[model samples]
Target: MASVAINMDENSIRGDHIASSMIDSELHECVRQGNIDDFKSRVQTHSAENLVTPCGNTLLHVAVSYGSDKIIAYLTEECPSLITTQNSQKDTVLHLAAREGKDSYAIKSLVESNPSVLRMTNEKGNTPLHDAVIKGKKKLSIFLASTDPEVAYYNNKYGRSPLYLAVEKGNKKGILDDLLKSGASIPIKIEDGDALPKGKSPVHAAIERRDKDILVKIEKEKPELLRLSEKELGNSLHYASSIGFLEGVQFLLQKFQEGAYERDSEGNYPIHLACKSHSVDVVKEYLDKFPYPKEFLNNKGQNILHVAAENGKHRVVRYILAHQKSTLVKPLLNATDKDGNTPLHLAACYGQPLASFLLLLDNRVDRLIVNNKNSTPYDLAAEISRRAEEEYAKTDEMTAVERKQIDSKNSIPADEIKGKEADTNKIGGDYFGVVISLAILYFHACPKKSLFERFPVIKRPRPLRGEEMKSLLGNLLVAAVLVAGVTFAGAIQLPQLRDQRHELNSTSRNSSHENLLYGYLFLDLGALSTSLVAALMLLWATFNYPKFQIPAVVLSTAMVCLAIVMMFGAFFCSVKIALLGSHGGFLAVTIIVVAVMFFLYLASLVFPWIIPLSVNQILLQVVLHYYYYIYFFLFDYSKWWLTHKLYDLKTKFSCY
Candidate 1:
């Protein structure tokens, strides 16, 4: 039995039935094969001028996709209404044309016939321009955008405009510029009907893409574009600084300083944003131009310094300290954020050792200051310093091993040492003799019975004359002894101090020669300690005898010489140990010793008069240790475990 399907009238076909024969088999095949003459002949025979494919793809869609530009032109001219017709996916002929390489002619033909086609979108809501951009067809994209400025502004399913799509495809600077010049709104954000949540404006987009040239153009033409707000009223400057666009930031600052410090909806000024961004240049420029009031607090009673320190901008903090002519340093330094963290506290918690150091350097940096959490900067520094020491220790160990390997390969043999034994001992002897002669000369040079001492017959003028001279001579003697003792200790510790005659005799006889050199170097701790004690005693003597100010000065000079000798000896010992042992450990110990010695030297230089504020030291130590231990340890362990697990999983999966 034959089944019968109802057929609508010709009038119905003209209206709704246009799709019926329009997508007939013969026409569909003809259009797909780009048989323009056959397509026209069939259209004439069936009188289905508006024929579409079964999928609603018109003759144009098939023609464009197949690069049949001539057929597309003929069809578009014959059926102008088909120019707007979309296939099942809503992709118009223009969308298809923009996607196909040779469809530029078809696209031009469609645009020329019906300019409205430029605005048509496909099933994905992609306009011809969007498709052209996605396909990186620059010429087609430019033509579409130029056809209608709004074409450049149209967004697709992803809420990304033609400009946005162009950038995503890479090297789109030229196309983006063309779009922008063709009346694309720089401040308008591409969004869905409800508007994108904190949508990125064109300026924000440009800043993110690091398109400095476009940014400059936008700034020049629409300076106020920089003032447009994004998420939470964040302006272009906020985004620019956040992304570290130095040029964009500079331009914005220059424009804003001409007065754009108006409060945003969030009550934040550009300076606040700059501080939040921790951009040293941005902060400096703003502060330098329009100095904010010292009392000026953000909506949160937080000053600029507070923002800088919180963001861990050491240079910014230093700049603020030196430039901001406000007496608010004490308050700002001690001021606590909403979280109860003072600037110093934040710096420490954030592991900003340099910022913390600078903050503490300010005498006004509140030593007794505590954060909202009641944590002091010193508390942070202590931990940081410990971790620093640990890291240095590890590095020293590695370095020491490397050095030992090198030295082992390069060092001379015992026979070679014996050959030079005479020369070495002679040098040592000469050094010792020089020390003795210098000591004797120093002793005789004392003003005991000298010309000045003989003039003490005029004692009637001062009752303390004899005592004062005695004190001076005493201070001089102490200074001389301090110098001589330190020098003698160093000379005795020299590598060539041992007698060469004994070393040569032992080597010649092939005897079980005692390593007297090693014993002298290591076991003579008594003499070294005694000399150090004598130096300290002399320093103390100079400190006590204020009346003998001149002699005290001389004694202090001796102490200086002692310190120099000690420093040199310590350095040589450290180098020797580093070269002879595991380089890593040697380096670690050397760093620690050098650090301690530096502090000691500094203390000595400033002595009873100027002591380092302990609070600052404590703060630095805490920050270093906490960050290095807790933060870095967790990060490294997690990273290592994750990598290992991933590698194992890959191996297992591959085997399977």
Candidate 2:
């Protein structure tokens, strides 16, 4: 309801521009102070019953505002038109009486006098029905909506019908039910000049605000609105799916079949939206509750995986790949868009390493497949990586990891990330810098007048100068010493579960833990032994064995891989179930699983080059010079290739 104010002396209100056709201030005081007898006497003498304030509100409007029924009766009896006379808001006494309170007597009297006022609209284009319904004057609104044909399809300046506005209020009052059942339009259209409210629809607003009451009212009274896209170009399901409104999604789906298969103006289905919303739960809802229509492509011919992969939504991609019905597996895995790009192509083009990893792990996806541009996914990845490198090279050379770190910092809200932006600018590049530093070490181990160095024009790593070599040697020596210390500490820290045995020589306790004590002892000793051997090799190459530069570096890499594997093995063997409680046991299991995964990843990336060249695991004819001679290194030449059959080598090691 509009704000009502009474000025006894000067009848001027803020929003209501009343007229100044006044007779006496005393008569106005009679009306304002509720002196009905005095008002009657003054009006009989002065005949100010038809007089209006500056806001065009009659004395009866003031009477209604102050709940002075006697004054309203006196004024309306003198001039019956005053009952329908409007203030600046076009509000008749009937409008105010209906809205002020449950003054049904006053409302009934006014409505019986001038039934036209029930349909009269204010300046905001709201009829008395709108005011009653919107202000929670439930009984009056239902009565007006039933009797007034003008109220059936009436739209306010906001292009909202009585039904729409009632629902938009999100009130539990039966106004929505009354108006909805009173023949009001499902979705009221605008008149020639009126504009719709900013909200897309009543149901859209309800879902956007999560107003389940309004939604339930609409769903119960009119499920048609849930599936109706009308002028909004999208239904309630699209709005809910875009934000992962799972309850809304589930309700709409269970209520109607088209709700699950609904699409927006752009031809994006609910599953496509759910995928891009980054909500695995909503995606699961679509997969489990509805038909998993793998062939249902958007207008662009992109499937759910295409949407997920392009947005870096790895979890959604994983869920879709892992959870869909088996019959649809082929289409879901290999479906291509109009551009002839599969999900893998999109993942690679966007440089999502996790998405790429997940997609490649699925054997059904053809990584060698090319897009319309005649480029494979790996080619696309390399192309994007090169472009990123060049773009970053222009502005301080930010590598991908550093770029992500910077992006994460930048992605914070502007006010929250004050001095941190400039602080990041001073930090070094990430893993790429570590790689460059390692390459520098490899260069330092070479001869001063090496063939590549003799040709100064060659862009190969130049051998370190005498002073540079001294500094490099110092850093290497420090690293080697740290490695030796850590390996020795790891060896001594190995737990002996055998000493904690229940029986003197029970094999069950011993074998129950997978010979854990022996594995720990062997792994830790191997790490310690390999570390010392590599340290010796490093010292020899840094000082006098420049002639054996390539051989020493190969031996160092081989020992490093062996030492890493053995160190993990020692850590894995030490994680006994007895030492850790249930939760801790779960955590230990998780750790080992992650370690095994990372080990496999490392093997996939480095094994092609490392296994054949490793001093600890060299093969027969060509590379027998290293592995058999080094008992100090722990690696199996026989079992190295056994794991290779598990992995299909689509490319060499450096392809990554």
Candidate 3:
């Protein structure tokens, strides 16, 4: 009986140990699979909040890490005190949630379970807000701050508050407001030894963030904060401008009116700041309000214009020129910095031709002012202008000659004449005779020998030598003699011809035929003599002048060809008129033919270089010629076009 009883006791102890192992296995399986329902059921039945798993994560830590919002809710509802529970790393459930930035609902659930969870800090002494701010989780930060304002005011191990984190991350406005309202010290210095000193204030933080609105808020809420100076730097305005916060600049200027004129440790005013920033509007506004003394040099002895020109701010330079009367444009124009470079010298050195042009227009800009390297503005402009002139001169000469030809053609028709009958006859006959003589001279002097025949090339006379002078003088003397003879003969013969014609007409009624014959002879002799002398003078002029020789030859050749064609057409028409007995129609046709030939002759004489070719061929040639021209223009003029575009942008939009 005793042995049987001992057997039953041993069996009972083994059954209890087996039951405990089965329960632990079930909990492990539920945690592994993330089966929230199973885990919650196990926790509800067993209260496993304090239970440590294999890696030392509590049931709460595992729940937070898995982001199981429902598991979290169930555990918090059941336990109601696991909100401050820390895992292996000493991270509370809230700290873990904030660190992962994935458990907002879980965090809210835990917070609702216990509002004091906001004060819970992690192993690194970072509160829930610290993690939230670091992760840029504004929603989480707001939640924690709303739960308890002290959470927002809580500093991390590094002694940076939620406001510092917000400013560092450049978050939206409400986060800082909440922190400030929560008694976060507005003037509190970040305890990080590397941060600005104790009185540095949050305005420095805002300036570091470049947050204009927050800076404005801080300034308005605490105007004394604007006067608050950092340990090393003097004022917020100095730091703001040094960091190039244009909006911060405007705000600081308004808050601290005369204080904006204050220089930083580096002795740079807000104007210098604006110039360095290249903010034209900011510079203009500051210049308009308080004109800095012209002698008030910065540490570098650079006035505002020098700074502006060095930074390539032409608008600022113009503004300084227009507004400040005491500012000497000439002294500033040639003023060199430590590098010994005037504004014009710097502009040219930097390859800013437009800026250089503006500076050079100032008579004060010493054209001969040499830099440290002994280079002058004139040297630069001459180099640039010379390159430009060489490129332009190559293509301009031919265009000028072509335009001159067109103008000459438009002015007068060489063949038109108006006079008495004898004068008209003398003009036409003499013109024709001159044309023939020119053609004969060209054929004799520069004869076109057959292509198959070998001939010595004739050398043109050099103008500087005596050969050309002798020929020209000889021709001029012959022309003078011809003109004198013609004038004397015309003067004497005109009255005689008039008397002879009168006598012929008076005797026609009753006199003999001898008087009529003698009158006709006198008229013919006078006309012939006048035409011969005038023709000789014209020919002499054409033959002597090298300038007129080419055109004369071309015009004479075209006229000869036209005359031949007109004579043939007239003869054929005359024969037809005689057969058909239509003299009026023949006369009209003759006039039309003469007019068309005259126009063709004129065109050939005017533009002898233009070859008569097919229209398509000419168009293709023209297109090919202008294609390269257009390409060259587009390539070379691109800089000017870009400069114009930049000017338009600068004038139209203030930002540019």
Candidate 3 local accuracy as lDDT?
0.55
TM-score of 1: 0.48
How close is every model to the real structure, measured as TM-score?
A: 0.48, 0.51, 0.41
- lDDT tens digits, residues 1-656, model 3? 99999999999999775454333767766765668777766766664655665445666776777776667777777776567777666677787777677645666867886876777676777778888778876667777777776455455666565656776666564666655555333343334433223423467778888888787666555455576556445577767765667788788887887766567656666667677665666776666666543554566666666666545566566555555564644446566655455665445433443344445445555656665556454343323333443434543433567767866766754334221211211221222222222222222222234422212222332233245434544554454444445434534544543343344343442243343334434433443443344345447545576665444433433333333333333333333323232348768678667766765665444343344434333343334435533543365346655775798799789865
Instruction: Summarize candidate 1's per-residue lDDT along 249-322 as a digit string, tens digits.
Output: 77777765432455555555667767767566776666566554455566656677766765556557876776
Evaluated at residue 312, the lDDT of candidate 1 is 59
lDDT of each: 0.58, 0.63, 0.55
Clashing pairs for model 2 are 17-54, 17-55, 18-53, 18-54, 18-55, 18-56, 19-53, 19-54, 19-55, 19-56
Which pairs clash in the backbone of model 3?
none
Candidate 1 vs candidate 3: which has greater TM-score?
1
